[model samples]
Target chain A: MNIALKEIVKNKVRFSILGSIILLVSLLTFIISGLANGLSQDNASLIKDLPSGQLYMNKEAEGTYNLSRIDPDIQEKINSQQKEAVAFSIQMGFLNDESGKQRSVAFVTSTESKLFQKVKPGEIVLDRSLEEEGIKVGDTLTHDQFSGKLVVKSFVDQKKFSHAPVAYISMENYKEIYRTEDMQLVFVPTAESSLLFKDLQSFSNRDFLKTIPSYSAEQTSLNMIIWFLVVISGMLFGIFFYMMNVQKIGLFGILKAIGLKTSDLFKMMWTQMLFITLSALALSITFSQLFTSLAPKDIPFILTIETTLQLAAVFLIIGFIGATLSGIQMKRVEPLQAIQQGEV
Target chain B: MLTMDNVRKTYVVGDVKEEILKGISMSLHEGEITALVGPSGSGKSTLLTIAAGLQRASDGHVLFEGENMTTMRPEQVRNIRASKFGFVFQFAHLVPFLTVEEQLILMLDVSASKMKKNETKQEINKVLQLVGIEHRKDAYPSSLSGGEKQRVAIARAIIHKPKVLFADEPTASLDSKKSNEVMSLIRDLTKTLKMTTLIVTHDEDMLRYADHIIKMSDGKIL
Candidate 1:
């Protein structure tokens, strides 16, 4: 006799209200988490796609990547010492097409390495997003400061920086446009943390991303909202079961009087919690995944299976704690009181 | 058979001590119905609860089949209550969500009965028929009338075939006609099952069904 399941089946309206609330809360959480991830990818996919490594910037830059300019001598020395090391620089600029349409882009130039696209002085590589905006391979695009026309060589996928498309240009063109020969940073691929360079500070790939303005602030706020929703769902379970348990106090007392074990009562409560949570989560996962596929192209939304499972696990654990907290009252009920209090 | 020797129950409220049952001794024989009749707060209900192991006596010995229940551990007592004792409260107190059939099934599960599934179903139907409510076995407590709900409660109490049955104001919520029906049903079941039955009630008309009557007042039996 599965009394837990029987009760749920008997009281459809009461349980459905709780199930719908959980469904809405979990769906909102998944969607928000997806947007946060999408915005993160849009904000810094260029740096995020790099292999795990150490980034060296001039110590005087004070954690600001744009302000950091690595000396040419130090860059060359590290490049010679670590064969995999690459020196790179990025600057926000504009590219004008043949029709004079100005498109914002992050101009990037790096030392000869397989990690970045190699472009000739008179050629450029563009991000795929720019190709979608009417810029194509072999199109001649010019910059205001360089005074030269560079043909777009090809396009790379997902290479974005600071919410703008990346344009891989030659070091010579970059120097001409920005007037600097020194690169902003040195990246040593698969480098150990103990390695140190004089007059420079080191940051891991993850810490380096924090140096990008708006990245940390944006991610922090979105993550806070996701966690708040998770916690509120837990509290919802606590209060819901608390109210339900309060209403059933007399019933519980009668059951207890009739020789039902306290552990049996707890088992019933747990079974109901699992049933409700898993059902709501299954629906929410299905709906959120559907939203991911149907979302507008301009909307940054990327919900991964791994993140969904992790959040689901958290909701289950928190719900268990919440329901168990409310069940403490069941252990305190005296059958004599219910017997004396009259009908259940 | 069950025996209560010098049973005393004391309740304390705000530094004031009140004795509800003052060292009362009684015994219930097998295959008989014993009624504890009294006015309000006469401790008949309290005595019934103590004998049924729902609570502990402040001081006394409760012996069931020659085993001292008051000295046993709480888990052991609860085990006895589940496997050897049955209870019917003042109100029907039927589980609101369960149908009449499921209520009996729940009791069988609580008692850890060894009957197979088909046998258990047969036993439930048998008890429901004995209480004259077999036609309403599929109904929930809310759908049942006052008389029908009490019949289901009685069916649940004895479905496990317990050795002792404890009822506290079993038909207090029903009218005089329905009360007599319930009382007669209790008497017939007690004799038919050969089970020891102890009931607490203040109604004088119900005493005719009891083979033995212990009237209580001011915490002492007269």
Candidate 2:
């Protein structure tokens, strides 16, 4: 008979109110989630793009990547022991174009490896974002700290660090500008956790991301908002169903009196929950994906199918828990009591 | 046929044990209306509920046919209530969302009837027509008048062709004219279907339609 669906169709305004609330909440959640991912990519795509591995830095640096300096001897030893290992260093710096306009960049230099772009001492590769600002291949750029001029060899896509375009320079140029004889870190791709060295701490790829101060703080706050929305939506289902079940206690009792199974009542409530949640998720996913494609280039909004589906699954499970909890009252209702309570 | 052999029901509140039906015993014959008439708190309604399997008897046996219902499990009792019994309360108690036709269909589903699609529709129509509300089969409970809602409730109750029909003050909420109409309908259905019927009511005017009238006072038949 599908009494649940019939009730929803008959009382359109009532169910629509619940549906609209879920739609708005899930839509807001999707938008915020997209912004959070976008900001995360903007803040540290350079390290985030790296394959799963171990990162070793000086133990005395106290979890600060910039403060960590791996000795040249230790770097060479690890490099020899781990064939895929690479010693790398990054520092915030500025470059002046031929027109004398200064632009901030993260100057990164790494040992000869396939993991990073290999640039000659007199050449450089830059993130594509710099191309939008009129910098092109073969353009000569100058650094104030060094006397030599370097030509832009090419441009790479989406390589960024600390919200700035990454400029890949050679180890010789990096040492000349910073006057540092040692690399800041050693990265070994696909390395096991058991691999350790004296006077150094190893961090997994995910844990290494936490070493960046702005990355952790930003991600933590935004992730907290996402979880809060998820929980609020669950409670919304609880309170909303609680109220609806309360009003229909008499109806439930009457149905039970007529020999409807208790499990049947639970099924009815579950069917309604799934219907409402799936509908809202479909709309929110469509709108969020549309926003992803049409949003301004500077908005930094990125929503993927994987994240959307994961959140939708969470909403369904939470809503089911909420509705089931509220339905506990239905099991306790006595048909005799309801029958005595006058008409439903 | 249904029989009660010294059935008892007691309610305990805090430290006090109050007995509602004290050693009640009765029997309902096939194709006859048995009315339980009593004043308020006289336990007539309690007896009806116990006999209908809506509640448990504190002591003694409720035998339907040859099986003692009191010794059966709750699931078994519920199955009997779903398939072998029908109920009509004082109020219509129709599901507000379902139309008159859907109400009957829901009852058919609950009873687990094996009627096919066409047979189910024909049965629903037949019952609605018998209840004199065939034209209002598409109407929701909210739009139906009090009498029409009761008629639909009656149709829902009998759609499954239960063996025993239970009515608890079925016409107490209706006017005198409407009450007589409902009583006459119940009497006609009981004889026409050859089913055992038990009714609990305080309205003496409705007694003329019953074949057996048991007047109860202080939980005992007088």
Candidate 3:
């Protein structure tokens, strides 16, 4: 709008340096943000998509899905209040492939679930990530050193979670896979059968995640990693830009002496920094997503627009703060020096 | 025209109370070229800065066409300078980021919001031609020579077509030939525009251009 602004915008070297820095910060923040989001989803993707209004798991178990087994008596109380009850079998352990390679996986007892109800006997839904390790339909998955086997029935859209994949299977199929009859729960797919079981066992779906020992801890750790990235991105960006401004004392004084107001000059600096940050972040984020799509399956990087927006907002905020603190030296410019210092 | 009435300025250096200018009085006429001449410690630049409203006088009034500028707010003073005054410092402090054309336009871009782009551009071209740098319009300050920079500074000073042009040692950085060229251009431009001009210099060679020369020694006007 003014000479100071026009000059800054037109000055390629200064703007390029600033813009590139903002872009790097934005990209880093966005990637970390994406990973943070991806991490949380990985922790709960299987549970979050379950169709049941409530899931019943053992309150006595260490975790929601791992150690929790519904006390067979609570099923009766849950059935009296609901039209249907589906017994769910949740298991977490390693499953070996035909090639003798093992991968960590979660087993969902095939009960008619609201969210993921399509289950057939001898069939397993593979997590999206494990698809790379020779996982496909008709492949046999051996559980616990070949104690049992189940044919991979279908590979659904469930995401690649942190380090494991989820498989949904019928109780009979899960029983054969796990080599145990301890998972005696039935999915209340039919309305009438649910009432019969509810009189004997307690159940719920929403509180299922709370029953897992590692669920909350896993989520918190992933979020902590994400939060760490958020912080460092802005801090590094602000420091670099602040230092750049600190080096321009002579330029600022000349502008002030020639009657450029300090506030306007500051606004110009902030606007310049913001423009740079926003553009760079956008460019980096767009390219990163393309890279992610072309990357190998095991690398779990998921970028979303929501994550990018959050990252850009942070970059802009940090840029403004840095430019503001950096421009504090603007007030210290002795305008008189511009004139009093001899022309030599 | 610019006038300072019995103006006084003081400086504080710890316990020392040093008076820079002690009751200096002078009146400069419209369209007349005036020189403020003094030794190093005689407060010539101090008086000039106060008259330009860049600094405040400890006492007395500065008048521009009978307008009491002494009590004017900084904003008011800034407006006065933007609309009524042009300044040429000893050093041509052209914004390094801008070209010679942009440097001249910066003065006319008084408000950071709205700019007089067309008029300022027209004026820049006119002044460049007047100062004889029309050929070097696109050149940056870093690319310009010493005399060329002073010529650009003079071009910037008259770009706004202010009521008065203030030059503090405008020729101090230039050789004799360049100084004559810059001074003649200033005088010719001032006469053509009929704007009052003032210069503060220790250069006695420049004394010829001044219609009225105020001599200063020890903060006293002679």
Candidate 4:
């Protein structure tokens, strides 16, 4: 109840020093958190907002239409039993714009999707970054490294994969470009099935993407980095606080002899650390916002609240644990020794 | 009333046990100023610490109001220390950054009293005025002279109106003139408040102000 917030305020130098350190830590924590968040969002930003709860794809196709062998019979079979099905097809290929560079994403083609309606046949609908790269609407792009030519149509939202941007196209046009005979690919609801879909592999979007080896493998690599940074930082904070406590033995001994209880002293120290973490988090987030503003959207950056909270929580918990360990050292300080030795 | 009955303190260095206080004992009555004077390493401060419940005695007991102080739990000891005992030390230990008035306020902040904030302020101002540093209430410790800082330290100790005020070399760092003046202030404060005060010091000159004198040598009261 007697938390001395005023005492902290009064000692502006110590308070500010502590707060500044905490703020720096918070900022670093936030940056790492934001980057992790941005990576995840960039990975599935557009797909996460899909209106349908699940995506349906051919079984043999590895969860994506690009790999799926679709038959209209199976698409028709699934549609008859329940809600209407949206037959969509998507593939990955290079579009050599006027700048003559190959860029990639699994270009989705859906007659049933608003995303696809933006692109016209033989025309490219690429990310706006392509515009800055000297590829404009009137420019021509070579598919699959000069395999063919297509006109640049317009810019849509930039969804990235391994640093490549995705462009949406119509199903018929998609087929026309790829020249593939399998035009039976489609999306259906989770529950609907019919005999016509008999001999067909159906999958929702989440599972459909998981079927892609690259999605799972890419996530694994990125996740390792994020987890490492969080864990290492947490440990680093814990150790730093612990050492600070250890270095103040004489001071603590003096305080203890003068009747400052271990509990009270530790609470004060923890509050100091909390102050540090909070300021750092705010600063880091602010800096990250600055970073986000300067960079293009196609950089695959996505920052979210959940990421910040998760990282900050990590720092706080680590710092507290460090405090607990340091507090235990206070028990070793004998007032008699301090007084007799004149240490404090 | 407070009494130290044959208390002792010892420390173990690696594998060796070193004895510090050797069966020290005493009694402090109300309105008395006692100085524990001794050479360096004589354990005067250690004895005082044991008597104040800040340090546990290796052997014997400290009794306050007929209760065994050395036997009480640490929380109980801390509770009493806050409400019944006060402290002053050589360094002025004023928390470095607080103004004089703010420093005095910290003494009462730890106590669980629902006494209104204004009452707390009144008591703090009263202590400052009594210490004759009311004019410097807004000043920080670093800005004050040695004498003035000790005056503030005295004010801090008595602001809580503790039953016992323990000072460890209260004037050790001050010049003789400042030391005497500070000692006089402590004597006056004790008389005014009718509280028991025990000061440990190596400065022999401080003895003239003490109502009771206890000479300590090698942890023994001589």
Candidate 5:
């Protein structure tokens, strides 16, 4: 006889209230987490999409990627030493279409490398988002700083920088627009980049992402909210079970008096917790995944299966801790008290 | 059979160590309803709980079938309490969520009974009928009348065929008519099952059902 299950089945309304709260909390966490990930992708997908490697910048620039100017000689030496090394520069700029409609774009140029979209001097490759704005192949775009007009050659998928679609242009056009020959960063696709350079500081992929001004602070606040929700859910689990346990104190005492093991009472509470958490998590994950797919393209929301699974595991563990803490009173119940307290 | 040899229970509040059961000794025989009757604060309920293994005595031994339950580990005592003893409290104390039938099934599970599934079901039905509650087997405690709930509590207590039945003010929550019905049911079941029974009650009318009535005052039997 599974009394735990029977109790849940018998008092559907009571248990559903707890389950709904868990579902709502978990759903909120998932949606917020998705937004956080989406915002991250929007902020730096151009750099993040690249494989893990070391990014070298001028040591004197002090963690600001734009201010970092790699010396051409050192860049040449490292490029020769590491064949996979790629030097790149990104500057937020705008482009005017044939109709003179201006659109924000990140002007990006990299040395000959397979890691980036390659474009000829007269042509431009753009992020697919520009295509949504009606820009297409053969459309000529003009920039205020550059003397020449750039014809759109093609569009690539999901390449963004500093929340702007990347416009992959040739080194010649990039130099003409920016009027500087020095690239801002050099990326080497190797784990061991501990080799000393004269004026460059080496950073891992994650450390380099932090060089972007608003990225860490934005992620920090969003992550704080996500964790706060998780903590609140955990506390809610504890408090809900605490309230239920308080109501059942007399019943637990009577059960104790009747020779029910204290562990059995704990088991019952845990069984109920596991059932509620799993069911609630399953529903929330499904809804969040649906929301991920159904959300408008403009909304920055990305929920991955790995993240959802990890959060689900956390919710279960936190709920277990909460419910178990509340059940401490079960072990403390005196059957004599229940015997005297009048009917449960 | 159950025996309490010089059992004492002391509870401390602040600095004072108050003795609830002071060196009490008693024995309950099989097929007899042994009533512990006394005034409030006279420790009849304390004695009953100690003998029932609901609480541990501060000193001395509680022997059930020659085993000293007082000295046994808590888990060991709990095992005996689950298997060998049945309890009916002042309130019906039926788990409000469980139906009458589930209540007995829960009891059988708590007792760790090895009866086959069909046999357990048969035994639950048999006990429910004995308590005149077979008709209410599917009813939750909330829907049952006071008498009916008490009957279900009794059925749950005895469904596993315990060696001893402990009733503490089992009729306290019911009116005269219902109290009489519950007391009569307990008496008949104790006799039929040949189990030793211990009861604690202040009500004078309930004493007639007990085969051996012990009056206590100041923690000692009179």
Candidate 6:
């Protein structure tokens, strides 16, 4: 006979209260996690989309990607020695359409490499988000500093940098528009060793992303909230089970007196925890997945299957730990004390 | 038959060593109800729990069917308690979540009985009928009357046909008429099942049902 299941069935209202609380908390967690991931993707999808490698910049730039300028000699030597190495630069600027509408964009230029879009002189590839805003292929967009009008070549999906749509321009046009001959950064795809050079520093892709202003601070606060929710849910389970276990001490003693194995008592607690957590997770996962799809276009809410599964596993482990800690009382209860205490 | 030889229990509080049951020796025969009567601090409950394997005696031997229990491990003692001994506490202590029938089924499971599913159901029905609570087999403990709860408790106690039955103030919560009914039921079941019974009670009215009454004061037989 499964006494644990019977208890849950008999006391439906009480267990439902607990299950509802868990469901709400889990749903809130999943939603917040989705927003955090969405914001991260919004902020740095350009760098994140690249293959793993090292990003080298001038050490004198003081960890500011915009201020970094690699020497022409160093950039050329590193590019020749490393396979698939590309020298690139990004500058936050604006484009003027035919109606004089100013659209913000991160102007990007890279040497010959398959990882980034290659455009000829006077042509530009823009992020698809700009197309959603009414721009189209072959539309002429002009920069104030350049003499010639650039025609839109095509659009790529999910190409963003620093919360702005990226515009890939030719290396010659980038030099002419920015009035600079030196590239800001050098990226070597899948490079294992940092190149030894004077007056240069190498950063992993993740470390390079932190050099972007506001990315670290933004992600740090959001991640802290996510983890705090995870921990709070764990503590909620602990306190809830502790209260239930306290209420059931007399009953546990009597059961032990009647020769119920201590292991069986633990199994009952674990079964209840698993049931409650999995039910709540199922509801939350479904709703969160729905939220990811139906959320407003402006809202960056990306809740992926992998992230949801990871968080659910943590919740289960933490719930198990909490319930097991509360059940320590079951092992210590003496039947004589409970019997003398009268009715349960 | 169950025999307790030189059973002793001493509890140390702070710096004082207080002996609760000092060198107590007793025997309970099959088909007999032996009542242990005493004042509040006379250790009657302690002795009962020790004999029922709910607690360990500090020193001495508890022999059941000629095997020494004091030397056995806790799990082994618990196995014997589950299979060979039945208990009814001062309160009914029926699992609040289980119905009357499920309570008996829980006992059979605890005892690790080898009876088939149909056999187990038949046995539960038989015991429920014997205790006169068969009609309420589907009722939860919360819905049962005080007297009815005690009857279910009794049915749960003997569902697996234990050799020894222990009752510690089994009717302390019932009225005078209900207590008499519970006592009569216990007495009738003790005779019918040939179970060795040990009961601890404070009410003088309960002593009449005991086949051999042992008066205890200050942990010793008087």
Pick by lDDT: which candidate is best? 1
Worst 10 residues of 1 chain A by lDDT: A335-344
Candidate 3, residues B1-222, lDDT tens digits: the string is 677889999999999999999998889887789999989999998988888888889999999988989898877877777777888888887777788887876667753324356766676778889899999999988889999998888887777778888899998888999888888888898788998988999999998988889999989897
**Model 1 alpha-carbon miss at residue A285, Å:** 1.0
The alpha-carbon lDDT assigned to residue A294 of candidate 2 equals 95
Listed in order, each prediction's TM-score against the native is: 0.98, 0.99, 0.83, 0.76, 0.97, 0.98
Ten contiguous residues minimizing lDDT sum, candidate 3 chain B: B110-119
Worst 10 residues of 3 chain A by lDDT: A190-199
Model 2: docking quality category: high
Of 1 and 4, the candidate ranking higher by lDDT: 1
- Measured over the true interface residues after superposition, the C-alpha RMSD of each candidate is 0.7, 0.7, 3.0, 3.6, 0.9, 0.8
Arranged by lDDT, best first: 1, 2, 5, 6, 3, 4
Q: List the residue pairs that clash in candidate 5.
A: none
- lDDT for model 3, please: 0.71
lDDT for model 1, please.
0.93
Q: Which candidate number has the best DockQ? A: 1
Deviation in angstroms for B99 in model 3?
1.6
lDDT of 5: 0.91
Regions more than 4 Å wrong, model 5 = none
Candidate 4 residue A312 C-alpha distance from true site, Å? 5.1
lDDT of 5 by residue, B1-222 (tens): 899999999999999989888898888999999998999999998898888888889999999999998888988988998999998888788898888999888898899999999998899889989999899888898899988988998998899899999998888889999999999999999999999999989999999999999999888888
How close to the true structure is residue A210 of candidate 1, measured as C-alpha lDDT?
Answer: 94
Share of the reference A-B contacts seen in candidate 1: 0.89
Predictions in order: lDDT: 0.93, 0.92, 0.71, 0.70, 0.91, 0.90
lDDT of 6 by residue, A1-344 (tens): 88888888988888888888878878888888888888888888999999998888899998898999999998878876876889999999999997899999999999998989999999999999999999999999999999998999999999989999999999999999999999999998887654556788888999988998889998999888888888888888888888988888889888888888899999999999999899988998898888888999988788999999999998899889988988888889887778777788
Q: What is candidate 2's TM-score for chain B alone?
A: 0.99
DockQ per candidate, 2 decimals:
0.88, 0.88, 0.37, 0.28, 0.87, 0.85
Model 1, residue pairs in steric clash: none
